[model samples]
Target chain A: MTTANPQTNETVETIHEETVETNHDDHGHHEQPPKGIMRWILTTNHKDIGTLYLWFSLTMFFIGGAMAMVIRAELFEPGLQLVEPHFFNQMTTVHGLIMVFGAVMPAFTGLANWLVPMMIGAPDMALPRMNNWSFWILPFAFLILLSSLFMEGGGPDFGWTFYAPLSTKYSGDSTALFVFAIHIMGISSIMGAINVIVTIFNLRAPGMTWMKMPLFVWTWLVTAFLLIAVMPVLAGAVTMVLTDKFFGTSFFDAAGGGDPVMFQHIFWFFGHPEVYIMILPAFGIVSAIIPAFSRKKLFGYSSMVYAVASIAILSFVVWAHHMFTTGMPKVALLFFMYCTMLIAVPTGVKVFNWVATMWKGSLSFEPPMLFAVAFVVLFTIGGFSGLMLAMTPADFQYHDTYFVVAHFHYVLVTGAIFSIMAAAYYWLPKWTGHMYSMTLAKWHFWCSVISVNVLFFPMHFLGLAGMPRRIPDYNIQFANVNEIVSIGGFAFGLSQLLFLALVIKCCRGGEKAPAKPWDGAEGLEWEIPSPAPYHSFTTPPEVK
Target chain B: MTASTQSNKKLITYLVLGCLGMFGFGFALVPLYDIMCDTLGINGKTATTAQAYDQQVINKSRTIRIEFMAHIQPGMKWDFGPTTNVLEVHPGELVKTAFVAKNNASKRMIAQAIPSISPGLGAKYFHKTECFCFQQQPVDGQSPADFPLVFFVDPQLPKDIHTLTLSYTLYDITEKTLGEALTGPQAQGVTP
Candidate 1:
C-alpha cells in the first residue's frame, strides 16, 4: 500500500512522517492495508505493480488470443465460417492490437518492473508512483478500445495500422474514440518508458557500473529510449489522422495539399522502431539465460553490449524498408534497401556472440535453455526472411502479402514470445521459491515450436502465390494453405494451455527452490533469497 | 527517492495542468475538426496546373480503365450516358475522345477542370494516395463519380478560385460503378 522510500539528507520520510504523527509513527509500516485487496489498490511497491502488470497482460493475452481464434476459424474454410467480412476484419484488427499493445509489450514491462531494481541492486524504481499510474492506465485504455466494437457502425476495421482514407473517410463513427484511446495508451507508454530510462541511467547501485549491468537491463535501457523516441511519432501520426478525418486540415489528403503516402512515411518511421521495441528485451533475456545454462561466462560480453547499441542506432534509419513498396522514389528506395540490409551485420554480431557464449561449455538444455535455443534458431529464420524482404525488387512482390505476415509472426511469436517463455522458466524458481515441472515446460516448448512453424511456415508459399494479407476470404487456390495455417493456429493456441497449467501449478507450490539454482548464474538477482522479499536491499547490496 | 523529491511537485503540477489543457482541447477539437473537414475537406478537386495529350501514345504495354466527364446544364439530359470505361488503344496508336455537353439551364454556367494526373499512383509504383490525380473537372453534373453527371452551372460562380469537383467512379473489370452507386450512393468527387 505504501512505497519503500529511503531517506536522503534533503527529503527524509521519517522526519516528514513524525511531523504529522499518527498512532503508528513507523515510516516503513505506516498505514499499509489489511494485506489482501487493499495491497493491490494503494500499492506503490515494485513487486505489487509488477504482479498487476503480469496479471493484466495475461488476461489481455487470453482475450486477444480468443480474437485470434475467431479469425483463424473464419479462415479455416474457403467461405466465411461465422462472421461478416467487416466483422472478420474487425477481429483481425483487434487481435493484433491486443497482442501487440495488450500482451507482448506489457509482459516485458512487468518483467522490467520486477527485475530491474533487483538486478541493479536498487531499492525501487526511480519513479514508483508514475510506474503505478502507467500500469493502471492500460486496462482502462484497452477497455475503451474493446468497447468500441459494439458501437453503432462497429470498431476499427481499417487494420491495426489504421491506414488513412480508409481510416479517415470510410472508417466508422467510432473512430474518434479509437483516436482518444490510442492517445491514452501512448501517454501510459511514454511515462513507463521515461521511468525506465531514468532508473537505468541514474539508480544503479554504486558499483553496478554500465558494463557491470546485466544484458537484460542494458537492452531495456535501449528499448525504453526507443519507446520514448517513437511513441511520440505515433502520436503525431494519429493526430494527423484525427485532423484529416474531422478537421479541414488535410495532412493525409492529397487534394488538401497533403499526401496519403506521407502518412506511411510517418507511420513506418514509428513502426519500424516498434518492431525492435518488442524484441530487444527478448534479446536481453536470451543473453542472460544462454550463459546461465551454459555454465560459463558470456563470451564477448562487451561485444554483445556494443552490438545491441549499434542495432538500436541502425533501427532508426531502416524504417523506410517498410515503405519500399509504397511508391517512394527509386533513389530513396535504393538507399533504404541498402540501409536495411546493413542492419544484418550488427544483428549478426549478437547472434555470433550468443553462439559463442554457449560454445562447448558444459551446456545444459533446461526448459529455459530450450526456449532460448528455439529463440535463436527461429529468430534467425525470421532474420533471414527479413534480409530477403529488405531487397527492393523482392519487397515489391512480398509487400502486404502473407509473406509479411509470416515474417512478423516469426519475430513476434518465436522471438518475443519465446523469450518471454524462456524468462518465465529461467526466473520461475527465483520468483516462486519452487521449481516448475520441467517435463511440462518441455512439452509446452516443443508443441509450441512445432505448431508455430506449422502455422507460419506455409504463409511464405501462399505469399509467393500472391495471396494478399488482411483479407477475410481467399480464392480457392489458397484453400489448402489456409486450411493448414488454420490447423497450425489451433495447435499453437492449444499448446498455450499446457504453458498456463504449468505456470499456475508452479506458482501454487512445488519442490523448494534454492538461492542460486544454476551453477553459472551470477547476478545481483541470484544473490537474493528465492521468492525475493517485498522490500529488498533497503540498504544497497555491496556488489563485488 | 532523491529524484522524486525534486521532480515530484513539478510533475504533479504538469500532469494536472496538462490534463486540464487536454480536456479543454479534447472538447474543442470535435467542433474544430468538423468545421475543417466541411470547409476544407479535400474532395480532391483542384485545378490542373498544366497538361499535354500524347495522342500518338506509343507506351501502351498495359490497358487502363479511365473515367472522364464534361459539364452540361442541369435539366439538360444527355442523350448518351457517361463515357467512363476502359478505352483500349494500341502502342504508339493515336486515340481520340468525344463527350456530350449540353446546356438546359435558364442561365449560363461556366466550369473548368482543376489540374490532375491520370492512372494515378495506382498505375506506377502504386502509392495509391500520392498519385496526385484528383482534379475538379468542370462538369455540370450531380457529382463527378455518379457518371453521366447531368447537372447545371451555378450562375453565381466567382471569378476567383472557382473550385469544382470531378470524381471518376472507377470500377474493376468485373465490377460496375452503377451497381456500386445503387448500393448506397457514397458521395464521390475530388479525392483528398
Candidate 2:
C-alpha cells in the first residue's frame, strides 16, 4: 500500500509539472493556507469551506432539534405545559425554518463542496472566494433569526410559511429582521449554487463527458439549477412582505387590490422547487452509497439522471398543491393535483432503480448502507403520503393537519436528514483518515430508525383524528399519541449525540483507513489519498 | 481574456440574468394572478365593470340564496357589514341591499372595497347594475357611509349551486392615494 501511494504521488507530481509549464500565466502562485483561526476565516479552500459548512449545519441541527424538543414537550399533554402558546408557535416556526434552510440545505451544499471538485477531478470549486462569502453569510443570517425570539412580540409565529396579513400586519417589529435574514440567506444560496454550476461546467477534467459524470455530480448540477432559479423568487417574496408591512403598498391587502392568497402563490412558487432542492442531493448521495454497498454498478445511470431532471422541471407547476384548502377553484385545483401526482412517476423510477441495483448482488449493510436503505423505505412512505395529499378532496382534510407534518418529516427527517447521516458515514473515513466505530453506528441507526417512526408515525393518526398542526395544545384524546410521539422525538434527539461521538472519535484517531475504504466504490474521490490533501488534482486527471 | 475566462464571464452573466428574471417573475405574479382570476372567474374575484346581461327573460321558477359578507382588513379601523345577511331572490329578479361602513379612525380616510363571489363559477351570472364596490369610498372622520348594491342573478344560473356568497373586503387606501397626490403636479399648489 505504501509503495502504491508513492507511485501515484510521482505520477501526480509529473502531471502538475506539465500543467504548470503550460498554464503559468493563469494560476499565478499557489500558497499554503494561513495558520489557526484566520485559516478558517480567510480561507477560500473548498475543503475548508466544506468543513465550515458541515460544522455550521450540525450546530444548527442541534439548535433546531432543541426547538423541536420544546414543541414536543409542550404537546406532551392536552394543555400547554412547558411554554406559552405564542412561544410554542415560534418554536415550530423557527424549528422548521432552521431545519430546512440552516440544516438540510447547507448540509447538502457542504457535501457538494467536499465531493464535486474531487469527483470531477478538478483542483477546487470554481469561484472559491465567492464560496467563502456564501458560507460566511449563513451564520449571521441565522443569528438574526434566532435573536428575533427574544424580541417584544416574539419571533415569527405564523409558521415557517409566514402567510401574509398575519406576517405583515399582525407580526412583531422583529419581522423586518426575519425578512432581511431570509434575504441574506437567499443571497448566500444563490451564490453557492452559481459557484457549483460554474465549477461543474468549467472545471471538468479532460475526457470527462457530460454522460460520464458520476450520479452525485449529475444531481448537484440539477440542484444548482433549481437553487439559482428559485432563491431569487424567495428573495422577491420576502421583499414583498417587507414592503407590505412597512410601506403603504398593499400587495397582500385586499382593499389595496391585493389578495392574501397571492402571497401563498408567490411563496410556494419558490417553495415547491425549494423542497426538491433539499431532496435531489439526497438522491445523489444515496445513489452513490447504494451501488457501493450492493457491489454493483448503478442499475440505470442515465435513467436516474433523467428522473432527477424531470422531477426538478415538474416541481414548478405543483406549487399550488400546497394551497388546495386555500379555496382554489375546481379547475385550478384539478390542474395542480394532476401535476403534483405526475411527480410520482420520476420518483418511482428512482426507487425502482435503487431496488434493482441491489437485486441479485452481494449486498453488505455497513452503517452507510443501513442509512441509505432506510432512506429509500422511509422517503417512499413520505412520497406515498404526498400522493395522498395531492388528491384535492383528500388534501382538504389533510391540509394543515399533522398528516401533513408526518408526510414532510417522513421525507425530511428520514429522507433528507437521514441521507446526510448516510453521506457522513459513507465518507467519514475519507475525510478523517480513520474508520468510525461501527457498533456504535449500528446502535445509532437502530435507535434512530425506531424512534423516528415513533416520533412521526402517530402524527398520521393524530391528523386523521382531526388534530390540527401548529397548535400548542390539543384535547384529551390526542394525549396518549402525543406522549408516544414526544418519547420518539426525545429518543431521536438523543441518538444524534452518539453520531456526534462517532464523528469526534474518528476525527481524533482510530484504525487507519485505506485510500479506497470501500472495495466496491468507484469515483475520482476514492482515487485520492485518505484525508484528501489541502490541494487535490492541481492538474486535472484524465478521466479515461 | 483567455478562452476559459471569457466562458466564465458568459456563464456568470447568464446566471445573474436568470436570477433577475425569476425575481422579476415573482413580482409579475401579482398582475398575472389578476389576469388569471379575471379570465377564469375564480378566487371569488368579481368583475370591476357592470355586465350587460339579457334582462328580457325573467325565469322566476328558481329561488337562489345569496349570502352577503363583509371583511374589514387590518390597519383599516372601520366597522363594516351588510345590513342584511341573506336574501332569497328568484333567478333574473333584481334585488337591492345596503352596506354600512363607518370609519372609526380619528382622521378621514379613503377606502376601497374589492368584491368577490363564492362558487366562483357564479361570478359571470351575477351582474351588478350599481354597486359601492365599483369605486373607492371616502368616509369623513368617525362617520358612517351607506352604500347600495343593485344586482340580478342570471336566469341561466347553474342548477347544482344552492347558495352563493358575495364578499367585499375593505382596505384603507388613504396613504396610497396621498402618495400619488404628492407625486403629481397638484401637490405644488397645495404646499404653498
Candidate 3:
C-alpha cells in the first residue's frame, strides 16, 4: 500500500468511485458471495463465470473422450465391430466439434476469465455481464448439437470440415442443427473475445504498460483478436452451408457456378487461424510455467511475442496447405506449401526459447513442469509431421490419412491439451486456496504422458501404411498398431479420471496454501490473496 | 462514468465492426476466389460466354486432342452424353460438337449445362463461340435432343497441355424457372 504513486492512487480512486456507483454490494467491504444456485446462474463475478466455464469444459472433455473411446474400440480389430458406419461417422464429427469448440476453447476462456483481470490487477472483467452471457450460451449451443445425433438419419456425418455437397446434398436433417450450433458458438466466442480485448486494453493498473503486462495477458490479447477476426468467418461459412442446403442457393454447388472446393477454401481460412487460436494461449501458459519452474527469466521475451504475431499472420496465408490434393494450380500449390513450412520457424523460435529458459537454470520437476516439458517435446514431433505433410507431394499420400490424424493429435492432444493440464496443475492452488496432492498430480502426469504417446504414436505408422481416416473398419494390415492404439486410448481415457480426482480433492481441501504457493511465481495474480478473491483488486496494485 | 469505460465503449464498437467486416470478407472470398481463378485460368473454370475466333493466331503445328465428358446432377432425370467422345483439332480451327440429352421423366423439363475445362491452365484458352450452354434447353421427353457446341482453342495455351477435357454438368431447372415465372410475368396462379 505504501508503494502507491500519485497516478496509481488517482486511478484506484476513480475505479472505486465507479464500482460504488455500479455495484452497491461491493462497497468497501469483504462481502460474501451470493447463496444458492442463483449465485452461479445470475453471477457477474469473473471467478463464478470462470468456474462455470471450466466445469462445462471438463464435462465436454469427458463426453468427447467417451466418443473417442468408442472410436478406438471400433478400430481395435478392423472389420465392422461396435457401431454402424453411419453412427461412427456421427461420433467422429461430434467428437471433433465438442473437443474443439466445447472443450479446449472454453477452457482457455475460463483461464482468461480467471487470470487476465487478476494478472493485470483489475477489479473484474471489463464487461462481466457479457462474460456471463458468453459462458451460459455455450451449454445450450452444445445441447442443440448433441441432441441432433438422435434425429432421423443421425447427425452431421460430413466430417467436422463439412466440405460441400456431402454437407449440402448428402447430409441428414441434422445439418440445420449443426449450423445453428456453430452460429451460437461463434457468437459466444466473439462476445468473449470482445470482452477480453476490452479488458486487457482498458483495465490494466497504473505503470502496467503493454510491455510490462504478463505474457499470459499479452498472448490472450493476440488470441482474442484472432477469435474476433475468424469466428465470424466460420459463422459465415456455416450460414452459406445452411443456405446451400435449405434455401436453394449454390454457394458450394458446382452446378450453380459455385465451387464445392470454395467451401474448403473458406473453411480452412477460418480453420488454420483457429488452430493457432487454440495453441497460442498454450504458448502463453507454457511460457509462464517454464520460467516459473526453471527459476529463470524467460529467454527472448520480446521475440516470443513477435514469434506468436508472425505465426498468426502466417496462418491466414497458409490455409490451402490442407487442400493440396484439391488440384490447385502448381504455382498456387507451391505458394501454400512454402508458407506452411515457414510457420515452423516461429514455432521453432518458441520451442528454443522454452528450452533456453530452462538451460543451466535451477530446474525442478513439479507436476505442471512435467506436463509443460512433455508438451515441448511432443508438440515438436507434431510440428515435424506437420512440416512433412506441408510438402505438396508428400501430402498427396498423407492427405485424409491416419498420418494427418496423428499429426494433429500430437499438436492438439499433447500440445494444446497438455498445456491445459500444465496450466490447471500450475494454477490449482491459487484457484482453490489449497495445495493439491503432489502424489496424485504426478500420477496423472505420468499415466497421461505414457498412455497419450502410445495412443497417437502408432497412428503415424497406420497413416504411413495407407490407412485412410474416419473409416469404421480398416485393413488387416493395420490390426496390430490399431490394437496398441485402442489399449492406449482406453488407458489415456482412464488416466483423466486421476486428474478429475485431483481437481476435486484439491477443491475440497488438502493443505492451506499461502497467497503465493509457488516460490518462483510472479505477476499480479500472485500478489492477490490465495483462492483469488471473489472480486480481485478492489484496490489496484501499483505495477512498478 | 470513468475515462476507461468511455474508451472501452469506443474500442468495443471498432472490434464488433471488425467482426462484421470479416464476416463480409468471408462472403467476399467467394467472388474473390472465382475472380482469382478466372484471371489465373485455374480451378477449371472456362469462360461463360463465346469469344471472337481469330484466324491469324492459328498454330498449325499444335494438334490438341479435346475430350468431352457429361454429367447429370442428382435428381435430374435426364440421360446426357457428348456426341463425340473425343476430337483432334489444330488450334484456332472451329470445331462443332454436340451433346445428346434425353429427358426420361414423364413431364417436360428445362435443363441448363455448366461447363468445366481441365488442365485448368487450358481453361481460358478454350473459347466457346456458340454453345447450347448459353441458354436453357427445353426437352420434350419424347425424343433425344442434340445440343450444339461451337468452339476453338487459342494457340496461346500452355505448351505442356497436350490434351484438354471439357466437362458439362446438366442441371434440372424446371422447378426454378417455373417458380420464377410464377413469381414474375407468367404467373396467373398456374399449378404446374
**For each model, chain A TM-score?**
0.94, 0.95, 0.98
Please give, for residues A244-328, the per-residue lDDT of candidate 1 as tens digits: 8887576766444555655776677778888999999999999999999999888888888888888889888888798776655
Q: TM-score for each prediction?
A: 0.78, 0.92, 0.96
Q: What is the TM-score of chain B alone in each candidate?
A: 0.30, 0.79, 0.89
Candidate 2 lDDT for residue A406: 99
- What TM-score would candidate 2 get against the native? 0.92
Docking class of 2: medium
Off by over 4 Å in 2: A1-32, B49-54, B61-63, B73-80, B90-92, B101-111, B138-145, B155-162, B171-192
lDDT of 3 by residue, A1-544 (tens): 6677666577678776665544564333435676788778887788888889999999999999999999999999989978999999999999999999999999999999999989998888888779889999999999999999887888889899998989998999899999999999999999999999999988888779998877889889999999988999999999999999999998987756788989999999999999999999999999999999999999999999999989988989999999998878899999999999999999999999999999998899999999999999999999999999999999999999999999999999999999999999999889999999999999999999999999999999999999999999988989999999999999999999999999999999989989988888888888878888777787877777
Residue pairs that clash (backbone atoms under 3 angstroms), model 3: none
Residue range with the least summed lDDT across 10 consecutive positions in model 3 chain A: A21-30
Best by DockQ: 3
Pairwise TM-score winner, candidates 1 and 2: 2
Kindly state the number of residue pairs that clash in model 1: 19
Better of 1 and 3 by lDDT: 3
lDDT of each: 0.72, 0.88, 0.89
Complex DockQ per candidate: 0.06, 0.50, 0.65
lDDT by residue (tens digit), candidate 2, A1-544: 2333654555445545543443344343554455689778876778889989999999999999999999998988898677989899899999999999999999999999999999999787877779989999999999999999988889988789999988988888888999999998999999999999998997787767899999889999999999999999899888999999998678998767788999999999999999999999999999999999999999999999999999999999999999998877788899999999999999999999999999997999999999999999999999999999999999889988999999999999999999999999999998889999999999999999999999999999999999999999898999999999999999999999999999889999999999999989999999999988778888777787
| Candidate that would win on lDDT | 3
